[model samples]
Target: MTANASPRRWLFVLTILVGSFLLFLVQPMVARMVLPKLGGAPAVWNSAMLVYQALLLGGYAYAHWLGRFQIRRQAAIHVALLVAAALWLPIGIANIAPPAPGQEALWVPLLLIASIGPVFFVVAAQAPLMQRWFAADTRAGDPYILYAASNLGSFAGLISYPALVEPALPLAAQSWGWTAGYALLVALVAISAAARWRAGGEAVGAEAVADGEARPALRRQIHWLLIAAVPSGLMLSTTTHLTTDIVAMPLLWVLPLGLYLLSFVIAFSTMDRLVQTITVVAPAGLLSVGGLSLLSSGGGSMMIALSSLAMLFLVATALHGYLYHLRPAPRYLTLFYLIMSAGGVLGGLFAALFAPLVFDWVYEHPLLVLASAMLLPLPALFPWDQWLGLKPRAARWTAALLVAVAAFACWKMVDGWTGVVADVKWWGIVIFAIGLLVIGWRWAFVPVFALLMLGVGGWDTVQESFSGMRVRSYFGVYTVTDDPEHQQRRLAHGTTLHGLQRTEAGKQLEPTTYYGHQSGVGLTLDKAEALAGPDAAVGIVGLGAGTLACYRKPGQKWTIFEIDPVMVDIARDPTKFTFLSECAGDTPVILGDARLQVANQPPGRFDILVIDAFSSDAIPLHLLTKEAIGIYARAMKPDGILLIHISNRFFNLEPVLAAEAKARGWSAAIRIDPSPTGDDFSDLTGSNWVALTAAPQRMDALTGGIRPRKDSRNEGVWVPLEGRARFERWTDDYASTLPILFWGNIIGDRE
Candidate 1:
């Protein structure tokens, strides 16, 4: 090792870059491989993130402990640990299931840890520890640039998962490929460790003198945790909101996370001027568009789009930059990173683990926004800092009155739960005017600007989003909407349209929306007489708006299996969808998981069962498992058929159905009905329906009466999904939302 900067600097950069790249690359690749086994849902990604964060924190802690040793000892321990972790190589989860049934929430995390835990923990600590080693081995260079290289590697990995690894390889092949990369990573670590070892005996680098023997303050440590946690949690929350409420397209989730990673790149880079500029603008960004935190409102709001992206990038960069500024000396570098990693893990726990149980919907987004505002220092608009002299009492009162008026204006501005308001069209003019008048006082500016955002976009129809008028479950958000003649109820998870129904005078039960006459559900029910004769037994899984109830004929037994009680409550309320009242007035809606309930039902219980259980982006893996299919097969009569609704924003699930059927020796074919373009509402929705049947006679009977349109083909390769046979059967025993996230192509094709 020489003092010359040329070769050594390049070597340092290359090592950091490669290590970081491999670290981030594995995160998405492994996640994609586990999708089918886990279940494709947003919450699954959140869980996987938690695992990554937690492992990262652990790795940092390990690094911190190792750093306390001599240079040779540190290198020796790292080499040994890396080799030890490699023993569990070939990078795949263990073939293990939960000990008891119905414990997926608990078991998924444990399975994930058992599978990839050791491998990830070792790799995660490398960035911080390696940079410290570089600093200690070569005492002349600034290690901050290595941080930039590390993030650059991370950015590459995140980008590569969707663009290269997933599309290019299958799940099994991906595991082997990642294993090879892990081997290469081991070699790279060896090289770095060798470099450190060669740096002469007793390379004890400089140590900080203790002015006071006290350890770091508890408040500082908590602040570090908060700073890292807020942005990381918000990044996930933003992705959840955008995918579910804003736009449910492919690459949408990656965009927010990519930007989040990009923030770290900018924050840690040597370009101080750029960071300074962005930080200066971050406050204005937070105040201007921070109000529209609703997932229902899409990201096209000028203020929101700009401010949200800006605030996220700026605040994230600022906080990360602060972490870099307060970076511990080389002696304690791992400790600093350990604290940062812990913060990241905590953030994920709050967003993915705690929020779902606590808040009915995603509250992490607004909470993050408020946190960003507090962390960013504001510029003084007036020379006088005095609260009293800032603005006159009468003027302050007038401002409050104006805000109240604006709140009224906001109430009027909201067009629908789904669409943005018109007031945002003139938001710049409004915010600018308010900004001019409320310059000096923090309270005056913050509240009024927030009010203006509310009037323009934020508070519009918020009462509905909050008043339980909408229901967000593991499935998606269910809302009741009204038009001129017909009142409609819709369920959307991400951009994928799940289920919907219409009502006459907002109470008369009618099978509208996708289940209308034009839909396959409607067609099947319309010919119920020929299929099963009068008084046939019928079953529907998802009770959204209870539209399927309208298809019940006199003397027919109509049974529904609905998961969320909130949905049942909404449909049962006269103000919501009254399919139960207008259709099957006396029928009972069964509560609990549909598969569990149906699996336990007696044989020959139903002539037909329609599965419409998905909400938002969550596809219940348990319901689709092979064992569950056996239950469905047993529950229905020999002549009965099952209709599965596969319309989703982010996955190509037809293959899953096909594979399951193939494994069971049952037959399955898909039907694609295009949504009609008109104001009828009943005919204006698209659907992908897969009909499964064991008996050929029943299959023919089901599809014979309806006209067959050309089937829309999914271009991706269809692997045989022998559900739970190839992997852990998601049962009451064990399930996970950790690995089943395929955020690709949320919307398939235009109707």
Candidate 2:
């Protein structure tokens, strides 16, 4: 409030805003920098989040400790820290070598610490530190509102990286550009310091408060931690769930995180109405969306992704609104933020470090949803409680009735119903509508939500999960199920079907799914002897149930390169997929990243090589870069054929491949295999396979299978590719999925 302080208010706000922006911008940038060294699995982003949270906790603790110093000393110390951290600027991943297999989990944090630890720490402290300084200088103002501005800047940074920064600039440019922003942030922090240069140890916004307010109790601080942890863990779980259907690229990676930061904006703002409205809607959305998320997600990629994000925003806003409401006076502000950061680290560890090791499915998703239900401040919707003395009366009798109805629906979905659900929908609606009567009451509503979740899909997981049908690794979760009706065993990663094999006695020897007989890889392997001669050598990347193994010619040398050991086990086990066990059990299976492993191989080793890899329907960005292509080229003979399975649910990668081919003057063509709607549906999947070769004669051998285009349609034939505009050359330093993200495919129906 003083006129002198009014002029300085936006100065502190600017300092906090700039610092927070640079902090978040570096997170995704550095993660992308390290991506090639590891791999493009969704878990990689989750691990990166754990590191960010750990650093944030340290920053908050540092700010809280600084509160004990005099105002001028506090400002001086923070500025000194900022200048010191700047020595590590032009932020990039450390020059460390890639981690060994099974070492990615622990090694990721160490790598990040070496690279951006000091920069992120000093920047993260500015939000709380600047606000406290503003309060001390202004004499009286709610500095907490500045927290809203800080997160608003964070939302901007997260969103802009994927949308603007990444598509327009390369990694090297992005790094130097962020350094410029850090320099500006440093200047702003110094100006703020001069404006608040108080000499004595003024106890404003610090311990021994100016207002005589007591420190918050230990029990209450623990409550704050629990509340903050739910949304933190739930946000990561939602990201995993969404990317399972969409592609696991940075574009989609930023959406949930941006929303999470945006939630903090609303929760800490002066806009009470928006916060109240979201609080009223959050619990209901949690139950409804939570149930569908646990199931096959009621619809396509777009619908599931939208609903899950909405659920996260609503839950985050509701819980953070309560945090803002329970906030201590300005004296304990730093301590409050310190506790909140600790909770964030707890949640990230649970989801990123703990979940993959503990459970097979994304079991944390449902559990976090349940945790939200328990912690949220739910109020009754409509006048149901007002209209009813009847609600309390009904609660006694209807609890039993609702339980019985839930059990019946569970039966329809599970044991006796056997795929028919004619009556289940109406029964579920009736039970849910009745369950809404006790909206204000927590104890009654949670059971109804839990039982309804079971009826919808929980019981299916119970029966399906414990029977050894699911497995998890750093890459993703794998589910295996036998289709007794068709006599085929199936393998899936997330919602994407990776491979399947027929178990009909002698038919088990055939290859299926993406490698169907009409597929490009299929057509090339069929003519393997003609193209590479009798003793042809073959190398394959990504052993997904080893479906491509059955394509082997007798006495041909076939080799498998798989990154995930879990996938190796799934394919090698005779009990899982018979293709690898019976067809290529004796072949070599190398375990490591495909690019690195292929680079280590001797030059001109293979006559034919196939790249068939998927991390939950996402394209491996590292494998498609120019350097990676060069490594692959070195491993193959001059006349060798490279078959890359480019099928993806959320990206159209033809342009990227076309540009790579153009840069090297290699000839390339594609085959599109359409899945049928009939009896053979289980045995085939729609796919896009591109074949590239430096030698034109090698490509001609596979393209020769179909009649000329003048005589017939080029169905199952390799169509030639040419580079188009906006097709930037994809190198290790410069690559983006934005131009090729299949936006229409993600928003439209699943093709």
Candidate 3:
């Protein structure tokens, strides 16, 4: 409050802001750097998040311990820790090779921890520690408000990475930029330390008097932990749901995280009215948007994604605002953050580490939604006590039973909606019932809401579980479902159909989905046999039900490089689809990432190489980088062709591959395959494929009389990579999908 202390207070705020910014910025930067090595699975980012949360807990604990010491001693110890952490500076990942087969899950966490552990841990303590240090100065105002500044920096950092930092700087430059920022943070810390030293022993004695206040009870602390845990778990779950099920775009991960941090900013800001308003409306937002998220099933994906994000922000703002309400005095600031961080670690552990192992579907998403509902401050909508004064317990139990029955009836009714009109009517009825429950009885509201959510999606998951139709692994969830009407079995990875097989006795060898015989890869295979004879050596990158294996002829040497063992199992099993068993029987399947595996192969071994490893709509960007292209070129003969399955619902990848082809002096052509009409042995879907060959004559032979067209939407024609302004040559050190993201009306409506 004094004029002399004003400058020191601002200094502490600046230090905390800069430290928090660097803390969040490094998360995406380092994750991007390691993405290629880890096979670019979305789970890799989740694992990285778990490590960050665990380290944050460690940092908060350390800060709480430091709070026990005098201001001068605390400053000295923190300064030493910062200096020690600087030894791992420049911030690039350690020069370690990619993990071998079956080692990615263990290696990803270890790599992230070893690469950024010390620096991250040291910086993670800055917010609480700096607040504690400022609190020691009795003249400084309430230190809780400074938390708003910290998270604002975090929000800025997360958004900046995807929007500005990634587009402007390569990975190495990003690392060095972070290192420079770290150095600036150290300087700021030093200035704060000097200010504390100048305050002398009087300030320390004043701090001891303030620290003698009554401590929060154990029960209150546990409440704080639970309050914090729900939002933390919800943040990760939202990220997983959007990226895995809705859109597999890499930068989409930042939206939920940025909003989660922004919630802290809103909760702790000076704008109390705004926070209060959001808290008031939070319940309605959770029910409406959360219900929609649960009901979402490959339709209105953009709306579903936006709704899920809105739900996360609202739930987080309400919970964090409640945490703000329960915040202890300045003396207990570090302890408060310590408990909150511990809760965060628990939430992250459950979502990122435990959920996949325990659940067959993304059950964590709905379960966390229900938990958030329980934690939220609910309003009493009806006077139940007045209505049933004599036997209130019996009345409540009877009401609960009735609500359950109503929910079951609604579920059965909705399940019978096989027509669009019937579906619309059922949704209208469900919404009307939800509105009644919101006003009729508070106790029954959450249970009914939970039941509706279960009815929409949870019941489907239970069915899948009972039927053993789904399996969840670290890579993703795979579902095997049958369409008895069409006599077809399909393998789906998330929302994208990986492969489809006809159930007729002799039709098992047919190729479906993106691998139909008329597809680009198919045409390329035909040309390969014509050019290199019947015994041409071929390699396939992604094995999805081994659909492309049907194109293999006798005496043709075929090999497969697959990153996920689960996919390999599905493809190899005779009872599954039999594409591999009937076509390329006992084929040699190399287990590892294609980028690494292909590099290990002999030079000029394959006549053609096929890269078909897209999961859902997400293209593992690592496989499309320039270095990956080089590996493919090395493994192919001089005139060999490289076929990349660039079909995507969210991204237009032709430009990216075109740029790479232009840079590498390879001739490239694209084909957009048409979807098959009517029922047949093969259920062909629309697909996009790109073929690149180092030899122009080979490209010419494949293209023949077909002129290269400019329009990408045209079907079954070789498209030329004419317009190059939007394309950037992707490399291991630099790649951005923002430019090529599909901006059409059909944004999230992927087939």
lDDT of every model, 2 decimals: 0.65, 0.80, 0.80
TM-score of each: 0.77, 0.94, 0.92
The residue pairs found clashing in candidate 2 are none
Ranked candidates, highest lDDT first? 2, 3, 1
lDDT of 3 by residue, 423-471 (tens): 6457645653653445335567677767667655555556668776678
**Global lDDT of model 1:** 0.65
Residue range 323-345, candidate 1, lDDT tens digits: 66665555555666777778888
What is the per-residue lDDT of model 2 for residues 372-452, given as tens digits with 9 covering 90 to 100? 888999798744545655666665565566556655655565553345566667656654674565457677667777766
Q: Which stretches of candidate 1 lie over 4 Å from their true place?
A: 1-3, 6-15, 41-43, 97-102, 198-220, 294-311, 377-428, 432-449, 460-462, 481-507, 532-541, 553-565, 568-575, 580-684, 688-700, 703-751
On the 0 to 100 scale, the lDDT of residue 197 in model 2 is 80
